[model samples]
Target: MTTKNLPIYQIDAFSDVLFAGNPAAVVPLSTWLPDDVLQKIAMENNLSETAFFVPVTAGNADFHIRWFTPTVEVPLCGHATLASAYVIFNQLGFEGDIVRLQSKSGILTARRYLGAIVLDFPKQPIVPETIADDVIAALGGDTPVETFGVASRDTDLVAVYDDATIVRSMTPDMSLLAKLADRGVIVTAPGDKTGLDMISRYFVPAIGINEDPVTGYMHCVVAPYWADKLGQDDVVGYQASARGGVVACKVVGDRVHLTGEAVLYLKGEITVSA
Candidate 1:
């Protein structure tokens, strides 16, 4: 078997400080690899997500990006995309302020903004939905103020609470959550701290992450939700995880812009059989 070495970078996204945010492993590829190989690599890394990208030649985008958790490939991932852009701009010497990436979700752009990376992603609008009783029970029996489901995907559900404290104190039953029809649940509330407009916690046991530290894509749903509730188009969100991080969000007509910082934690190589 032919073996090849691939460069990988572990980055702490949504935080300038190391070990404080969601860490994602990024592998820059010159060409596409097999799906099983990508999944295996992601599993080996054992992070929340691993990102792979190859330079694009005949499209409006600079590269094609994909994301994988340990168990499955996901449609959209925010932190890993930010990490991939960081590697491109800072490591690969890409001389541009904006990096356009085409993915399963469509065209996504990462721009250098005010000392942070701003990610322009499609807003995942949600509508009211009846949440399963077991799902609510798994969340410690505190019912949500409102429940919503993403119109674009069947795997996402949003639970709105009245206070940030409820969101922070949740200790969910992962087995019950994994059995739900929706694969991921996002619990959000009005921010309690200064300078923050919203707070959120993400749980996706079906995707192999019990609780994501500082989720980017989940913000796509929460940002618009909070903006409408607060009557402000721009707001800041804090993910109340063990290793918490902040994300600044701006909701436009049909898009959500997320801004955060990423710091490189490790740069190394992985050998894969080809």
Candidate 2:
């Protein structure tokens, strides 16, 4: 059988500029695409992630959403959710003022607030842990004085370095990173150059992304950790990834709210063989 045609939208999430923020391919479908096909599409697109959406009605509200990377399906993705909401609200001309996503993680809601999109996500608090030799080798850094694992997946490794430059300048070994058991590693330090509370860089070679341009999920854990340390709930975050982006973060109860703007970059279609 011939493959059906699929529509795809490339959107830059968490930034207003075309090149800034994370670029995610949004594909809205009537039914869920096969996992293999989705991965193939993501690999073909070669973006950090590609989001797939399908409508679901539960109890009182109707929801739509799903997220995928080139290699695997993820439980949650902040930037892609922002990109999906952007497409639903602006491109599809969705009438509702808010969009709710029923994802593998749970129900997540996004709404327009003060010209920026705000996403309410679960707060992931991780306690500091002993740094392993392999983790340090993957990061290409001497053993950090302190380390923390964020969330249950242990995808985020918060390593505190002495200076911001040390965190920014170090070149990591992706091959070694892929061998790491965690989903991703995050190296961070107090920002000396900027007035922001802190600056960080995220690498996820294990999941097929060498470095994520801007990571909203990591901030879910970072925002809370830094908030308590700095005695402030609201703060700014800078992802030191090559194609970096900024995020405004706030911690509310058990949830962390991340707000940012997204820009539409490329629009195209995909033809998938059956």
Backbone clash total for model 1 is 0
The lDDT per prediction is 0.93, 0.82
Model 1 lDDT tens row, 86-174: 99999999999999999999999999988799999999989899888888999878989899998887768889999899999999999
Question: Which digits, one per residue and each the tens of the lDDT, describe model 2 over residues 150-204?
Answer: 7566656778776777777878899887787457877777766655877888888
**Quick one: best TM-score, which candidate?**
1
- Pairs that collide in candidate 1 are none
TM-score of candidate 1 versus the correct structure, residues matched by position:
0.98
Minimum summed lDDT over a 10-residue window in model 2 is located at: 57-66
Candidate 1 stretches greater than 4 Å from native: none
Please estimate how well model 1 matches the true structure, expressed as its whole-model Cα lDDT. 0.93
Give the range of the ten consecutive residues with the poorest summed lDDT in model 1.
175-184
